[model samples]
Target: MRWLMLLFCLGLAACQPRPVKELPAVSASQSVAELYRLEREHHALSALADVTVTRQGKRWSVTQGVVIERPLRLRVDAINFLGQTLFQMGIDGPLLQAYVPAEKKFYTGMATLDNVQRFTGLPLALPDLVACLLYSLPPGVVESAQIIETAQGVDLVLAPGVRYETVFSSGRLSGFRYRIDDLTLYEVAFGPVSAELDFPRRIELDVPQSDTRVVIALDDIELNPVLSRQQFQLSLPATAEEVPLNEMEPVDDQTVEH
Candidate 1:
């Protein structure tokens, strides 16, 4: 009799309807161009991030400040916990310059994709880095984009083998995944929104290929601040040794070759 009762209860439970998950509505007519425009409008101009970088089992927690003048200009300064400037790097068009005050050495090289990756541990072009920092898509023409409804939110698959899966909550972008093929290039998550700019107060970038991760917490982040071209310049003393960026090794044993 107990077995018969259990069988009846199981049959009744199986007949009940399962709760359905409602996904966010995505427009079928949405184009990549529209999304790009939206992203550009929301991009920040200059930001000062308290960054923590972890790479290859080593960690460097520093305060980094970055200024971006779109179309191809960037400057970054990293200061250690004791408030000593560790390094300063600038990217002007195709030229890349970096100054290490500790070593009193200045390095210059072409800002190629590979070179930037070797130095920054980010496998992306300069423009791509700017976009990522601003929580926007890279500046380019997408051959096609497909919008699909996902359990998390909406996914936009761009042409040339790139995928962006976005998660939205409370009508704001919470995070996203940048993927190439089956490999995830970067995973970006946004923290609480700033009351002033409506932008995220914190952003996290995780790079799985090189085991690198960067967490940026913003303070006094200015959007579209007036910046002069001179701010991007890196000046070195006459006595400072000049070295080609490709030949400059972070350590004596590790050499990065072009």
Candidate 2:
């Protein structure tokens, strides 16, 4: 089976799927068009979010201050209670930088998927993750989607023979699924649409491929915030030792959410 590399921004995943329903269907051109339009207009955002990661029944949750922009830029500042920095990560262009306060170490490397997975346990390149945060399709997506009517809704197949499916329920995007042959790699289910932002308030990114599930809850989300290039830069204390990513080992880091 072909590995489509359908990884979403920051290891988005699918949830435990309910039974596929054979419900009545209708045309969703307007809603679908609006979704795409929103994507096209989206450029940057800065927000505070609650991220929870569940792996094999163990859960880790944290609040993060996140800033991200288009064309491969991201910053995630994970802090502990009482407003202390726990870990910080940034990606600008091809460079990835992170600082762990507990370890008093600074990490830097090319923003490759393997290196990223080693540090964050998220098997995704920078672009894919940035797009995932935009609530848009990752790069290399074939825009010519084939919409098939189902028992209850429609499935938008983005690539032929790729088994990457985008499902819409009642004119709203409900989830994205990737299945190769009989094996399903993931199904990312979206929470309810936010009335103010018109986006999913939460996303359940259950990436079984990595044995990790991440659920991202967005409460104070702002779109297209005024931000500059310097926003993606990571700052570390001078005392922190700098290390290359290739020399590091993978850690079961605190993560969970799409």
Q: Per-candidate TM vs. native?
A: 0.79, 0.79
The segments of candidate 1 whose C-alpha lies over 4 angstroms from its true place after superposition are 1-15, 18-21, 25-34, 117-123, 141-144, 250-258
* Structure candidate 1, residue pairs in collision: none
Q: Candidate 1 lDDT (Cα, whole model)?
A: 0.71
> Model 1, residue 33: what's the lDDT?
38
| Residue-by-residue lDDT tens digits, candidate 1, 124-228 | 678877776776666652334677667666677776567887776555667778888899987888888775786788888888987878778888778878878
- Residue-level lDDT for 64 in candidate 1: 73
Whole-model lDDT per candidate = 0.71, 0.70
Model 2 C-alpha lDDT per residue in residues 1-258, reported as the tens digit of each score: 234555542245554456886554445455457457656877787878777777767777778888989878888888877789878888898999988887898989898876665544455567766776777666545356675656434455666555556666666667777666666676677788776786777877777766778888887889888888777887768899998887875544542221
